[model samples]
Target chain A: MTTWDGAAAAERVAIISDQDVVRVRQLVRTLAVAVKLSLVDQTKIVTAASELARNTLVYGGGGNAEVSRVDNGRKPGIRIVFADEGPGIPDLDLALTDGYTTGGGMGLGLSGARRLVDEFEIDTEVGKGTTISVTKWCR
Target chain B: MERVPVLKIGDILLVSIQIDMEDQVALQLQEDLADKIVVTGCHGVIIDISALDIVDSFVGRTLATIASVSKVLDADTVVVGMRPAVAITLVELGLSLPGIRTALNVELGMKLLAQEREQYELDLEDEDEEPAVSTR
Candidate 1:
């Protein structure tokens, strides 16, 4: 279910387990390279995608990641959205804290991923799981 | 279980993470490394991660655990050949990898490990030859 139109080159993959995290990183890297993002930006975006994919697996159970190359006005960028249908975050503020984790993680995925990207947004419900979207623009 | 082969170079054990690291593969590497360290009695371990483009939190934790375990077995560990981009990403990921030694390339890493082993030998010799004497 994408409303991205034809302008954006997009792909989706399941984030079900640890192997899926590797796949998500590869997909994000492919899109970032295709858009000619600098090596630093590519690494940042790929790492961010990895953290989110793991979160979708470990925290949110199983989910999927949507990666797209987009144009934000004249600037070209890559956007990744991760969606999960498992138990949702109970408190957004606490989850975004730098050293808070519920599942034995280093507790840096949310805040660290946010720092790596140009934009970040998250939506969650008590019982409806979560959606976290991030974008990294070429610099 | 997916196993990562550990190559023996003199007294140094070298493991290059060249493939996509599945969680099982990482665990296997840890188990195999413990056994190899005991059997080979290698004094140093060098992990080459240059081929790995990204190291997430879990992988980072695994590497740290490997280093710690090797340390307990009297083997020093050095991680070498991290890409510049991966370094930056690691910083952003907030994993400092404290107490883990890292070098730029395999050659440099080998040199560092040699120096470390030399120092360890010197320390042992001093322990055997010299006794702590209290001078009142």
Candidate 2:
């Protein structure tokens, strides 16, 4: 488990399976309310969490997503990490590219998740697993 | 630390959106589903916005695409449980959906789709009965 300890404002939560997406989303909702993220920031985080959890279900072969609060000195933010032991991305570059979906419709999971966060990162190994980290700070 | 849970009920595609939706994500959804909606073949789409506090042009665009794509896929699209504040924000942003249907709940959306399908079939029948005009 990659653990992060930031300001006291941070609250950490974990998602272990597809069933956890709703739980994680609900936690984020409460935190968003507590922090009072701007309309745009709130939407961004909520959508980001939803997309990331969807990724966990579709690509991760079911994994865990951890949610927490990040205080960036200037503003408070939300963070999410989606990790899976399923077949790791064989081609990270290609996976991030738009219109390159192996699943239904176009591939927007990773890219869309990136867009919803103030900061985003991904770590993966083929045949091993993958982890996606996202942070959204209020403007 | 906890895991997020998700439940998929057929092709309904239920998701709890964030309060603030981003521009790039919205555009991605629009482009991704641009050629996929069909109004006569699909069951319908349900987007849950109960967690959201605001809606932006990007989100509005994505939702609109879902609606448009559902038509192309012969499916119907509906946005469920929108917050009042978010609605006002969308209106203020001048965000509007095109060629899409919406409902306050999932049941209503399904019903709407059923009605639309019946109407579409009737329209098709009417067209079939009309005399064909040949350019030749």
Model 1 stretches astray by more than 4 angstroms: A1-6, B127-136
Give candidate 2 regions above 4 Å deviation: A1-17, B1-136
Model 2 Cα shift for residue A105 (angstroms): 4.5
lDDT of 2 by residue, A1-139 (tens): 2333445544444555534665666667777766668766676676667667767767778777777777867887777788889799998989887546676633666775675677889999988999889887777
Cα lDDT tens digits, model 1, A1-139, are: 3344455568899988778888888888888887889998898999899889989998899999999988878878999999999889999999999989988878988988998899999999978999999998877
True-structure RMSD for candidate 2: 10.5
DockQ of 1: 0.65
Write down the worst ten-residue block by lDDT for model 2 chain B. B33-42
B124 Cα displacement, candidate 2 (Å): 9.9
lDDT of 1 by residue, B37-126 (tens): 999999899999999988877788888989999999999999999998899988977888888899999999999998898777677776
* Per-candidate fnat, comma-separated: 0.71, 0.04
True-contact fraction for model 2?
A: 0.04
Q: If scored against the real structure, what TM-score would every candidate get?
A: 0.92, 0.55
